[model samples]
Target: MTDETDQKDQAVEKEAEEKFPIGGCAGAHAEFRKGNFGTFVMRAQPVPNIVPPPPIAAKPLPPNDEIYAVCAKKEIGDRRGKSFPLMRRWDDGKLRPWDIFIARFGKQYFAYENACPHSGQRLDWEKNNFYEPNYMKVLMCGKHGAQFDVETGVCISGPCEGQRLTSILCFVDDDGDVCLTGINIDLDADVEPVKVVDPNSDEVLENNGFKLQSTKREFFK
Candidate 1:
């Protein structure tokens, strides 16, 4: 009776294997005789992350000190009919030209690009000139007669109604010579000339005419 029961169980298992076959694990339910087969499983691992740090602070700059270079004598005053523009020297022993009217406003200096921002012409009427007869007050442009504040370089009148003169800032030295603390240089020393073409005639002119030929003269006694 026991042999007959064992034979019956073996026959049932053999029938199930024949019906299910291999690759039957793909189905949601794996058909099997009770506890006849074991299942194998694989799991993926979690990945780790990396983070970066913030940037460091920068160093501060040193204080500004007045720089100087010798220009023509004080008696030379404004170079009205002169060929070259006058300049204040720099700490590095370089020259920087004047954009202000030296005659009307005395020791107090102003520096600007010699070019008129409006028409791209030289600001001077003739040579180192940038003023009218009553030269004691304001600066005047030579091209279309634009006027500016002698102190602030602000345009008060003329073709350039709303435009202010381009200023290059500088301070005066102990010897009353002008000193350029800024990065700008004179038309004579460092910077290259500004080039432009005339809209009407197609003639090209160097806007930096302040660099016209002239001998350097010393003003300090």
Candidate 2:
């Protein structure tokens, strides 16, 4: 009688395994056998293969002489400005981090170093705020209230009067992209903030005064 009962139990287990071959909860298999198909069907389905997507490739850097797009032309409105942090090669032949800004006046766009001619401080009292609040006609230095002409970058008022902000050669390309050209820039360099140079210092004056060219040439209007 005991041998018959053991054989019966073995037959029932083999039947359950055959019907629910995925092998999950025994209680669920029992429920499946009882015709409770809702939860059992979900557990019995095979899992699908999950393939991960490929990594995206980085864009190659352009040659040092070629033009590089800094931002879109639509980003800067008329009488507005935008600032950017970048790495530039100074006269010392070392790559140094620097801040630059682009301003739009009427139909023309101008680009200049964000450093003030006085005290070597950044021009914005507020982050990315480079204009005088009253008229919005000039670039005001947040550090010392120095005002610079939007088109020429010449300091018209404040302690740095008669001085000029270092201009960067840039233009809006045919694609409507604002680009920096005719300059030695390292867009791919790891620009550490701690390495930024003092804009009013002699090193900056020598490098920027004689070496850097103004963007007064013909450009997209």
Candidate 3:
């Protein structure tokens, strides 16, 4: 080949080498040809939500036991059943504990946590409470106005239109009483209820079933 032609070919080869030092470089070659090689670089993998699942430990046996609350003769219908919520104390010395709202829906007793999945609000008008409204199959969230089926904690309305309420797996006992099966008693305070006061009025949300007020000074303050 001519001298000038040979020099031109040598310059092209050097440019190719500078562009892609690696042999089988298709992507790098494409970027270099497009004059955007300076901006091209490997991107980091995207991270997931990273929020871990709830800590579900050993399951409690039938006729759910509670170290703090009262055990009442919870009746359903012709068949009377015994049931209660398993309460736990909080760091604020407040008596906010994990509770199960048990009520007779049709032929059996239904139980679920009192917290709503939407905003972690209580699913009752009263604490450790339930509503047995006629012709209703799901439990209602008094805060966000969410409703969930008694058997399944599936939210039927409100902010969490498709989300299901946090479920506490439970089973019937030998005495036909219901109890939690897969619950971790020490599963942190996030899952437990928090004490709150009325935003407009001076009334505090106590455990009492009325315009509930907190008796404990620490809880209010």
Number of the top-ranking candidate, with lDDT as the measure: 2
Better of 2 and 3 by TM-score: 2
Would you give me the overall lDDT of model 2? 0.71
> Candidate 3: which stretches are off by over 4 Å?
1-96, 127-129, 132-134, 186-221
TM-score of each: 0.44, 0.56, 0.44
Candidate 2 regions with alpha-carbon error over 4 angstroms: 1-64, 90-93, 194-221
Window of ten residues with lowest summed lDDT in model 1 = 212-221
lDDT of 2 by residue, 1-221 (tens): 99999998888667656665465577676777788763442234667898989975443233367787999999888888888878777655577666788888877888998889888876665445688767889998765678899888899988889999989887888999899876677889876652333443332111212332212211111
Global lDDT of each candidate: 0.49, 0.71, 0.51
Candidate 1's TM-score reads: 0.44
- For all candidates, the clash counts are 3, 1, 4
State which candidate has the highest TM-score: 2
Candidate 1 regions exceeding 4 Å error are 1-104, 134-136, 184-221
For model 3, how does the per-residue alpha-carbon lDDT over 1-221 read when each residue is reduced to its tens digit?
Answer: 69999998778666755765444266676888888754333334456778889976543333324322122324444222222334444444443455555655556655566567777766655443354234355576655456676677686666787888666555555565555554435323344334545544443542213243323311210
Local accuracy of candidate 1 as per-residue lDDT tens digits, 111-175: 55566667866665544556653543666665566777766777787777668766655556667
